[model samples]
Target: RIGELFEETNGYVYINLQLASYINDILTFLFAFCCFFGTIKLIRLCRFNQRLNLFIQTLQYAGKELISFAMMFSIVFISFICLFYLLFVSKLDACSTLLKTSQMLFEMSLMKFDAHELSGAAPFLGPFCLSLFIILVVFVCISMFITIISDSFRRARKNINNDQEIFSYMLNKFQRWTGLKKANEEERYALIRLEYFDPIEGFPERVDQLLDAINRLYMTQISERSRMEKDEF
Candidate 1:
């Protein structure tokens, strides 16, 4: 039905394809620019510790804006891809007709703007070059996403390890305060009991444990990746 409509309108798919290509290019450029510049600004904000409270607040605000922008950009690009696939893949007869027409237009000098000259000559180059470019861009984008996710995992893992160390340290210190041996399991357990139940200290040991466990679970993949790298090298 869409193909018939497009055919009646005289190969609108060609214009759609060209527009999709340009939009995809623009989106890729914007994604790269935002990721690069936003990362730099975030790093700078992290470095300037004088206004710690205000810095954290501003970071949160900036994060919300970035997330909104990214979501909108992703939605727009993905919609274009979905629409293109529907027209080009689902309606192959119409798509083939449109491609052939485009080629004929290129040959007969019907188009004032030549796609061959646009792509630096040789327009009907079997789609390999354009496909390769798209594949490479997708690969880079995926890699960047993976890198960001991996770093987040690393940070979570480090925080978990640090929390566990702190917990152990506190346990040892409380044991010492109670005049108990560090090697005594009974004494260590008693110290933990006192740290939480004791009205004087009243620390939230269970909450701390839960937070540490959550962080550790998040970091598990990153830690596994690190172990694999170490083993490989």
Candidate 2:
């Protein structure tokens, strides 16, 4: 059915022709799968090491900053594109379609578009105003985005350290609960280190008391069982 609509005899079948689109879809899916697999491997590696985990968290925070920036940028960008389209829709060929007008303005904001296109459309004033807009976006808006990301990195770094310490403390507790008490020495030291860095009032003392109580209870039960076995014998 697709072949009938997109027959070869049709003059100049664009690359978006049915068969080509199907192949493109398949390739795009495969590419996406490869990227997903690579990301999973990177996350696994990060989980295996504390430093790598911190780095990945920093990246994640940076990504969140970028997403927020992009959202704000998009609103401003679309507003400007609409203003330009309304101002020179008939004057510029690029503004013939809203999509094209937006694309042209976005490229101009990046200083990537041909200035002559705007100049040719509306002469001197057109290029001048567009140039000013681009300068403002590149210098002011983009600089603010960079600052936001930098701040996010700083906050993420601090949080990552605190989170890792807390995680180590919890992991130690888990091990102790699961009868791996001997492995908790390192965890105990970690908790002590955390106390020095960030004072959690009475938390360390409480955990130590709990552990002691568990040990004493286990010992008392064992002694009672041994006594019972001797009487039965």
Candidate 3:
């Protein structure tokens, strides 16, 4: 009956599809494993040689750029494939009459029936899907690698900024603590009088000298404060 023939045809088609998918999965896994391990090994070997390491680092940067471009490219490529497959290829091979006749002439015509149009779809789809799958997998891996590098660089920049801010803050605090405000005019004159009139042996007139330095520091502090406010504004 025609029903039996239709069932058999469907079975053959399912078998072919299943076989193609299996092969695609196997190929994709192998390609990913090899590419990943090979890249890591190449980087490790490059590290042992300074010149080679520089070369590899340069290559890695270029590779990342290319990979980003490829990801964008793959999106377009997949879109084209889907459009072609759904709108064009799927309409060609939905039916076949290759086994309907007994005569040699009928058989030849039947052979050409599936061969001329629908036959190429299976072969092309297998390779196309395999290639697309591989590209997507590699693209995702590259993107993740780039993301990690970007995050690390961002964190490093933040840390350096924080360290510089801390250093400046500590320096300012130390300067303020060690360098006192200058004394007034009267205070300066008093200290000068003390240095000349009250002399202590071996004490070095410490208080009077200290007062003079404090007077000078007060003037310097006012100048510095004006400069700081100007800079802030």
TM per prediction: 0.25, 0.46, 0.23
Best by lDDT: 2
RMSD of 3: 24.6
Candidate achieving the largest TM-score: 2
Residue lDDT tens for model 2, 68-173: 7789888888787787888788988888888988888778767788887778877877877786777667777889887976787787667765555677778767
lDDT for model 1: 0.53
lDDT by residue (1-233, candidate 1, tens digit) is 55786888887554346776899999999999999999877755443333443444444544544575468546644543443334444333322454543343233232243334324332443244334424443444445555554554444444332433565678778887797944488866876876775543435776787999999987997899999999999
How much does candidate 2 score in TM-score?
A: 0.46
The lDDT of each candidate is 0.53, 0.78, 0.55
Tens-place lDDT digits, model 3, residues 1-233: 44575697975542335776899999999999999999878766545444454444555545655677668756754554454345334344332222222121223223333333433555676445434544553455446656756654554444332433565556656765687545568756976987885346645778778989999999999999999999999
Worst window of 10 by summed lDDT in candidate 1:
105-114
- For candidate 1, the per-residue lDDT at 19 reads 70
Q: Give candidate 3's total backbone clashes.
A: 3
Predicted candidate 1: what Cα RMSD to the true structure? 29.1
